[model samples]
Target: MARAGSVAPRQRASAAPESGQRPGRRLLPRSRILLVLALVAALGAAGFGAWALYGSQWLRIEKVSVAWESGSRRELTADQVLSEAAVPLGAPMASLDKDAIEDRLLAALPRLKSVRVVRAWPHGVGLKVTEREPSAQVPAPGGFAEVDEEGVRFAEIAEPLPSVPLLEPDMADAPSVRRFDEERTLREAVAVAAALPEPLAERTSVIRIASYDAITLELSDDRTVRWGSPEDSSAKAGALTILMKAAPDARHFDVSVPSAPAASGG
Candidate 1:
């Protein structure tokens, strides 16, 4: 069987070392492939669950409940708040924007000092609101404007609050009032009121401000307390309390300088 020209063509092998997989086509181990598939399936399931919770009707909003945290008077009624909130009635609870709802409520009702809008699980949205309280009253166009503890004029009331004293600021004649700050006087007066002890504040009938430096309080009995400026208010308040108890008969008490306090008679 001596070969002729081809010499048996070098006896081609049937299962020669197959060229090791192509450059960009390496095959993964079977177990590794199975793990990859499991991971993909888990992600897909999570995605579907999210879609159902955020886009389906099973968890849609069925009710919006408004609750008051503080027992104070409500400037915005429950019905009014509901009407203003306009919470998407049929939207999925998970899709509802809690921050947007809170912003909307606050925008519609400035009387709401603080508000919390949250998903009350299953199918409801809950709102907890605290109404602004009137700390003092100032003369408005036709009635009186109520100022909250933060020195914000929140409402105009036809009748003055009996318990809350009136705040009078003499700014009409003082062009210099605008030189320092537009609301400096009113803010200072509110600070003074806030510094006073609750019992003393309740007894006070009026707070007068001639400037940021001149803050005075008139008691229910027509007695007076001269509280100058907002600086050292805590010290002034403490001094006033002790002075009042020490000289209950004094008609006028000056605590502008709490360290060297003074008391005078009519």
Candidate 2:
């Protein structure tokens, strides 16, 4: 009955999928496996990093050393600072309390102006120190106490340094005590000493303070400068410089009034 010239239609192939495998099931399992491997690797790296930073001996402090600014007077020895620091040896460097160490050092050593705690990587701690320099000397029991520019009496020395001047603040009178207390008087005298010119400061011998307005400076070679109070100190210093240059032979110089400086009695 079929036409002899036309071929019969070809039949289509029908294949069933394998068991437990959907259209994208094979790709999903492979993606999940890669994600789990990545997560495990990240966790392992974090654990190792934590152990290396804190729990490992390689990052722990083994040796401690102290270093100070060069050309500064070494008022405190390395042993003194170390003893006060009391840094825990064999502790992890990353776990050290830098601020605590600095606080202890400053509290124990009054001569230290500043302290910088540094981790000298791998196995050491370094303490960098800046010491207070003596601006003047105040008479204290058993010896002289060195005062810095801020009027802080830091150290006691048997003999004062030659370049440093002596401060004798006698704020015992009722009027002076009422106007300015002993502490303020001391601070004012220190301020005056600090404001002096370098050349005059080196030549100065003593700073005597009876009242706030009665601050006097006794210089070498029988010279004297009548510096009033701490007020107008900058102006006073400038006036004194010019007066001294103008009257080199004069023995008495008064710069209490910077506008009208006086000089007499060579």
Candidate 3:
């Protein structure tokens, strides 16, 4: 029976879920379906574009051109690099292996320091090469070998370069030779030669390397320059320039310590 002051408890609200979604579940929005369709269409278009780039004849490679860096002075020819490259012709530009071509050319030509293979739009591939510069001429069995800045004996030349100094190294005594590597004394000699100024370099005949610390330069006039080691070469060179002018009649110059240079034996 109902109480006098209070009506029966209000009937509990319906326990069932709303018409839109069940409890703890969600409905997929119509906007989301459209977004998903658009994303899939964009992905399909990208895939088709990639396929066309990979297989189309209109984008194929028709010509391969080789270029040398200006004033390289290397014996290599563009034809030689191109022949060694064996570029994949008639293939799509986007699918060609440029690195492989560059590696091939470098392997075939020791004088080549670096190489680049570029895709010229439409139908051409361009190859550019930078060759190593000879820093010194080291004596070999029958001829001289050109050494680069990194002490690499890159090429053999019949005659030594007049501008570059010749190196006379006794690698048999170097500890590195026993270790199955190039002698450090030889590199020290090359460093000494590569640092000489133009006047000294042109008149320089041969560099004698007794060891890393005993490097001597024999000039064309038979004058000697005692260069102790490869360190402080720039400072030593500058000091030598001043010492030569200060003592024009001196025949021997020692600038191992630029701070205390000496000249004697006129």
Q: Highest lDDT, which number?
A: 2
The local distance difference test score of each candidate is 0.84, 0.89, 0.83
Give the root-mean-square deviation of each candidate in angstroms. Answer: 5.3, 6.2, 4.5
Model 2 / residue 179 / CA error / Å: 1.9
- Name the weakest run of 10 consecutive residues (lDDT summed) in model 1: 15-24
Give per-residue CA lDDT, model 3, range 1-266, as digits (tens): 88899878789897787789866745469778988999999999999888778866788899999887787766788788888999988998898898898888888888999999999988999998899987789888869999987888889988888878898875557554554334766776777777888788888898877656667888898889998777888898889889989998899999878899999997
Candidate 1 Cα outliers beyond 4 Å, as residue runs: 1-33, 36-40, 70-75, 173-182
Question: Candidate 2, clashing residue pairs?
Answer: none
Pairs clashing in candidate 3? Answer: none
How close to the true structure is residue 36 of candidate 2, measured as C-alpha lDDT?
A: 96
Question: What would you estimate as the lDDT of candidate 1?
Answer: 0.84
Q: What is the per-residue lDDT of model 2 for residues 145-238, given as tens digits with 9 covering 90 to 100?
A: 9998899999898986786789987777737778788888888888888888788788888998888888999997778889888899889989
Per residue, candidate 1 scores C-alpha lDDT tens digits across 1-266 of: 87677565587768555577554665679978999999999999999999889867789899999998967677778998888788999888877888888899888777888888888879889988888887778889979998887888877889888878789887666655767464877876877777778888888899988777777889999999999887898899999999999999999999989998999995
Lowest lDDT 10-mer window, candidate 3? 174-183
Per-candidate TM equals 0.81, 0.85, 0.79
Best-matching candidate per TM-score: 2
How far off is residue 23 in model 2, in Å?
Answer: 17
